[model samples]
Target: MTTTSKLIHGYEVVIGFETHTQLATQSKIFSRAPTAFGAEPNTQACAVDLALPGTLPVMNREAVACAIKLGLALGSHIAPVSIFARKNYFYPDLPKGYQISQFEIPVVQGGEVEFFLGDEKKTVRLVRAHLEEDAGKSLHEDFIGQSGIDLNRAGTPLLEIVTEPDMRSSEEAVAYAKELHKIVTWIGICDGNMQEGSFRCDANVSVRKPGQPLGTRREIKNLNSFKFMQQAIDYEIRWQIEQIEDGHAIQQATVLFDPDTGETRAMRTKEDAADYRYFPDPDLPPLHISERWVQEERALMAELPRAMAARFVADYSLPEYDATTLTQSKAMAAYFEAVAKACSQPKLASNWIMGEVSRRLNMAEIGMEQVPVSAAQLAALIARIADGTISNNAAKQVFDALWNGESADVDAVIESKGLKQMNDTGALEKIVDEVIAANADNVAQFRAGKDKAFNALVGQIMKASKGKANPQQVNELLRARLAG
Candidate 1:
């Protein structure tokens, strides 16, 4: 639901997001080690990843390509030259004692992510997106009171996407994050598996009066799921409002959200740029990208969602809403196109896919690709409807049979279920005549201009024929007979 900015105890909620999208590179960003998930601990860590003595970091070209693709996708500016800096920090997982990341200069800058909250269109402005390496994981369980450090994730390529403080509510923040996830996964830049920590969100939340300067913010780190992201931001917003009401000054700090309790607790004081001691990495030279390279990459890129949606509207004459719904996923769009082409009925194909197909998919909690009905099978069923072999109501019965795998073929299902429409004009006319004679009150009322009476007469004809008659044909014949 789209929620407007409402004052909570005379304070407005302000939110910004920082998302880390793990690039789908086969290897680490600066090392030749494998970047596959679920590997045994420490197996993917190499000399460069472990930051051993005399080992130097090498930039992965594939990772750079993925970053470039994202910049182009988001309409961001790809810096001609970018530098990597050492982000000094200390932790059990930080084997190098400092992380190599972009400080002052990032590769992609000034992008916007657009999404819809219910029917409201919202756009979140992006500050910058930079390429960085993921740190190792700290295993706490099954260690007998001693935590073990797993360097497998260390040196993994990541694109840290930072957004401006544009979202006013947790709903808008979650919507923006979901749209970003769709884009990254749609463009093949990231796998976007939240459970595996491929895409992580950090929301910076604060509260203030309408005209007041931005309040002190607390950063909620590492929200992996959209559900948790919303819960965390909601709890943080309430907490800040309560703090201000109680005359407690909100402080800048890093916090972790406990999903089980639906609360955010301060983890530590938030560090600023000065605290990190950001400096240019001496071992790695400045990265450069030529205009020709950008163009070449653009040429090889897939058609984006927006452009594809526009084409669907123009070529297929679909409404903007239907086009957008169909293009939500590439597989769904392709399936719709195939059905439309095979049946030569774009509007009908769109309606069935958006209505019946979508309903089933949502109920089963599966994607369009997992649908049991094939495009050809759906087209064949649509063809039966268009050729007047079956009425729409009958077609639905046939569809159900096909979807449930009761019949392998559309024609076979229709034939076996005896769903063919009663197109015999003589037989349909006799049924309509019989209904007219039987329902004298309805016919008289319909002639007296009661529209419901006419509909009742049509329903009588359908029942008389055991629902085998074409509804349109019955209406036409019944109206003519009554007029005569």
Candidate 2:
């Protein structure tokens, strides 16, 4: 490996993550407004969310319970009393000059979330995880030359999980974020839909000489995509190393990602916690959850993603790779189980899902939930292969047609297209004879033990069949004929 590829200078790369998980509540945190996505601009806003005069913030009990469940799951201390504070900021989308967030007395503290760095499970320490209300969004469009504001997502309940600066590499940080996202989604608290802005993350990055005081840190803001998060960290690490190499000091500032340019641009100087002017909100009362409420929330917790992934491995007798891929999404796991029950070999189902289904989704730039193919349909196709009704090559054709954006029946389409394999030995014999009679020179070369000449005969038979001949069957018959 090149020095640049392996060396991060004499300094070590350090990362701390702040992940925001949007609660799966039907309404906004502080209002009765519906919390739906892709709605008309500013339509979901209620008086409290819009900051109308005399309006008060009403806390959602469901949101509070969800946060408590996460806290317990992380093995953190759930403070019987946690206060809300105002984080002062200015933006068109933020109707209130300040956002309601947790500062001093957050709900949970000093917990850990464990994820695999490779084969080993490494736990990342958490500083805190707190409940907060999200701010609105500001959209800048190229066509209109005017910025638009969308309040549909504003005031949504958010659980911000902050971690200590324990991650040593970008790879570790990305892994930790992915694991945390799964836990939140699995618990049914947050949906963990990154593209929809339901689950997002920010990284606090810094570099320092071996055992030196921590270098100045920069905040990379609001990255929702995992791949983008990894790339952003990598670029920032390179940028920091280069700056130090050139005697330029690393500035403490907030940065924004330019996805188009594959770079992060300066947003503003990174603010200290003191800069937020954090103070408890007098308008709202402290949250006091009794022991009875805690137990009820505990009962609501479901099987965590890691445990569930392990169970799938043992119960289904699936390979670690297959289990990992299937459990990447909750929806994918459910789909896998349905097919696994229908088919005896869970591994077979896993292979088809990871191979064809995943390939089509990636090619079409869609999600598994949006895929046109279904578990039952895929199982039915697998049955056809086992029953010898279709060859493996023929089955691939049917899978392709099913994903081709048509309501095409798999068997009917295969029949209509004449995609069935030409397994008829009598017809194949006549074509093979005609090819050998026509190519006398090639036949002489084949008899003399030239394998390449023998291949030409198989290609001829396929061409005669318009590429529909069963290749294995053709090859077997031709070898028997050519030997005699």
For each of the candidates, the C-alpha root-mean-square deviation to the true structure, in angstroms, is 2.6, 5.6
Q: Candidate 1 on 1-484: residue-level lDDT in tens?
A: 2337867778888888999999999999999999999999999999999999999999999999998999998999999999999999999999999999998999998988877777677778889999999999998977587789999999999999999998998888998898899899999989999999999999999999998999999999999999999999999999988888889999999999999899999999999999999999999999998889899999999998778888999999998778877887889999999999999999999999999999999999999989999999999999999999998899889888888989879988888888899999999998988888899999999889999999999888999999999888998898899989
Off by over 4 Å in 1: 1-11, 440-454, 477-484
The lDDT of each candidate is 0.92, 0.84
lDDT of 2 at 210: 73
Q: For model 2, how does the per-residue alpha-carbon lDDT over 343-400 read when each residue is reduced to its tens digit?
A: 6668778888888888988998988898787887787777766655566777888887
User: What TM-score fits each model?
Assistant: 0.92, 0.75
Best by TM-score: 1
In candidate 1, where is summed lDDT lowest over 10 consecutive residues? 1-10
Q: Give the TM-score of candidate 2.
A: 0.75
Cα error, residue 197 of model 1, in Å, equals 0.7
Alpha-carbon shift of residue 159 in model 1 (angstroms): 0.3
The stretch of ten residues in a row with the least summed lDDT in candidate 2 is: 1-10
What is the alpha-carbon lDDT for the whole of candidate 1?
A: 0.92
CA shift of 337, model 1, Å = 1.1
